[model samples]
Target: MPEIRPRSTIVVTLLCIAGLAVAGVALAYCVHLGAQRDDDTGQSAAEFTYIPPNQAGLAADDVTPESDEVPEQLDTVRSKIMLCTIDKIGTDVLSVHTPDGRKHQLTLSPDTHVESAKGNEVADLTTGDLVVVRVIESDTATTVDLIVDGRVSSSIPDN
Candidate 1:
C-alpha cells in the first residue's frame, strides 16, 4: 500500500505539471492573436457596428455610421465644418453653440493655433463671438479652425 501511494502521488504531480505547460502555451497563443488584431494585417477582421438594414428608408450612402465621432483609439483629433457661436471658454477647451442652440466643446492641444485677424495672437475670445469652426470630430474637437468675420482666425496644427 505504501508503494502504491508513492506511485499515485508521482502520477498526480506529473499530470499537474503537464496541464500547467499546456495552459501557458494557450495563454501565449491568445496574446499573439490579440496583437494581430491591432496590426494592419489582412488577417484582421473588419470592425463594424450592427444595425438593421433599411430601418429609416435610407440608403447605405445616406445612412450615418453608428458612431459619427472620431474613435478614441486615435491619438490625433479630427475636424468639423460648421458655423456656431462661442458659448463658453476654459483653460483648454471652448464650447460653441450652433444656430439651433446645440453646443459642442472644442478641445485645444498644445499645438493649437490661436491667432487674430491680422496674424496676431487672439489672446481672448468671448462667449458671444460668431465663428465658423471647421472641425474634425473626435470625442472632443481634434482638429479645429475658428473663422471669424469671414476669415480664418485660429486653427489647430499648422498643416
Candidate 2:
C-alpha cells in the first residue's frame, strides 16, 4: 500500500492540466493552419478558368492591348501551368498524365522546386500525386518552376 500525500496529488493534477493545455494549443494551431490552407487553395484554384477552343478568339478580343507596351525582351518567356497526376517519379524527371489523356515527361533541374501540403521535397513525391506544374519556354531553353500538390476544385465543372 502507498501513502497518499496531498502534495504529490497536487503535483500530478497540475501536470495533467498542463498536458491538456498543451494539447489544446496544438489542436487550435492545427485547425488554424487547415483553415489557412483551405483559403489558399481556393484563391489558387480561382486563377484558372477553362475556355473552349472555339471561344479562345472571342475571349482574346475582349481584352485590349496596351500600345505603350514595349517589344518582347530576351528574357520574356511563355509559361503554362497544368494540373496533372503523377504516373512515375524519377531522379530528374516526372512522368505525368493530364486530364486531356496525354502523358508527358517533365524534366526537373536543380533549380526546380517541389512543394506539398506536408512540406515535402522532390524525393517525397510519389506516384499518383495530383500536382500543379509551371512550365516555362523561352527561345533558348525550356524550364520548369514550382511543382505543387493540388486538388480538383469542386467549382470546376466535370467534362
Candidate 3:
C-alpha cells in the first residue's frame, strides 16, 4: 500500500495552492476596481442631478438607483445678467458700459424692449442712462430686455 505521509502531504499542498490561487484572483479583482476612474461626470445622463443650489444632501458618492426618466438640462442659458449704463444709442445699435467698465455694442432686435422712467421709446434713450439689461441667449437666438430706472416696463422674451 501507499505511505500515508506522502498522500496526505500531496493533498494538503494541492489544497493550499488552490486556496492561494483563489485569494490571488480576488486581490487582483479588487485592485482592478480600485484603479478604475469615474468618467460619467458632465454626461447628459448624469447631469442636472436635481440638487438645488445651496441645498445640502445626497452627495455624489451616494449610491443611487438607475433612473429611466429623461435628465433635465442644466441652466446653461441666460447665464448672467448685468446692469449697464447706456454709452451710445442709435436706430439699429445700442452700446452700454457695465459697472466694471466693460462696454458692449448690442444689435437691436426689431422687437427689443426699450423702457425708461417715463413711457419712452428707443429714440428717448440717451447717454448715461442706467439700464437693467436681462440678456436671453440660447442655441439659436440672443435677445435682451431693457428696463430703465427700475420700472417694470418691458421685457424681451424668447426672441
- lDDT top scorer: 2
TM-score of candidate 3 versus the correct structure, residues matched by position:
0.42
> In candidate 1, what are the lDDT values of residues 1-159, reduced to their tens digit?
343566788899999999999999999998777656655655545454444453456665775766654455647565557788877777777777889978777775555555446543334566676766666676633555554433554577976
Q: Give Cα-based local distance difference scores for all models.
A: 0.64, 0.76, 0.70
Candidate 1: Cα lDDT at 120: 31
Ten residues in sequence with the least summed lDDT for candidate 2: 67-76
Tell me the spans in candidate 3 whose CA falls farther than 4 Å from its real position: 1-76, 138-142, 150-159
Question: What is candidate 1's CA lDDT for residue 77?
Answer: 66
Worst 10 residues of 3 by lDDT: 40-49
Which model, 1 or 3, shows the larger lDDT?
A: 3
lDDT at 128 for candidate 2? 89
Clash pairs (backbone) in predicted model 2: none
lDDT of 3 at 105: 71
Please write out the lDDT profile of model 3 over residues 1-159, one tens digit for every residue: 865676788899999999999999999998877666577454443243455444446676765554623357754776356688988887777788888999887666767676676656777767887887776676765456554554465668995
User: What's the number of clashes in each of the models?
Assistant: 7, 0, 0
